[model samples]
Target: MDDASSQSRPSADQPNPFSAVPIEITISVGKARPLIRDLLKLGKDAVLPLDKRVDDAVELYVGERLIARGELEELEGDQQGQLAVRLTEVADLQDGLG
Candidate 1:
């Protein structure tokens, strides 16, 4: 067998489709409202309210782009639960953007 032929083809021992893509899993996204410097003077237990309302759907972002919006839900036995995003709207938006 020639050196060129052996070099051009992959070996049998090599793994199939040998590449992995990295993905991030976001747990929760709430509107962040930073307290003013003067407000910090109040010290601990001082309530700094978030900009978003409880009924409002929280926006999910991947990198810098908006991905979806979901309502927060509590799972049984698990205090830290999942967000149920509206799939149809998200898919449509993603398709349109793409």
Candidate 2:
């Protein structure tokens, strides 16, 4: 006999209802910590140094969780070029969510 409750519950192969929900994905280029005094001294063209080099892979995050690594790219089109990240390495699902 088939179980009615089993049919109502989501199967392992089935897509989750939350999957359709929107999530904010962020690509972290780098990080910096400036003191209040230093931040206040910033000029119009002030440049703050980051921990990462230009060639370093950028971190992709979903909320606070690290998801993937990618390289920065420029989308060619209009007068103002749009910046984007090209995925290089994907995180393993078992490690977390890929």
- Best prediction by TM-score: 2
The C-alpha stretches of model 1 lying farther than 4 A from their native spots are 1-22, 25-29, 32-35, 77-88, 91-98
Q: Which pairs of residues have clashing backbones in candidate 2? A: none
Q: Candidate 1's residue-wise lDDT over 1-98, tens digit each?
A: 56897775667876535446666646345655575675666668866667777867766666666666667666545545754555323525545323
**TM per candidate:** 0.51, 0.73
- For model 1, where is the 10-residue window of minimal lDDT? 88-97
Residues 46-97 of candidate 2: C-alpha lDDT, one tens digit per residue: 9999999999999999988888999988888683478888998888856964
RMSD, every candidate, angstroms: 6.9, 3.5
Error of 2 at 90 (Å): 0.9
Q: How much lDDT does candidate 1 score? A: 0.59
RMSD to the native, candidate 2?
Answer: 3.5
What is the Å distance of residue 31 in model 2 from its true position?
A: 1.0
Q: lDDT for each of the candidates?
A: 0.59, 0.88
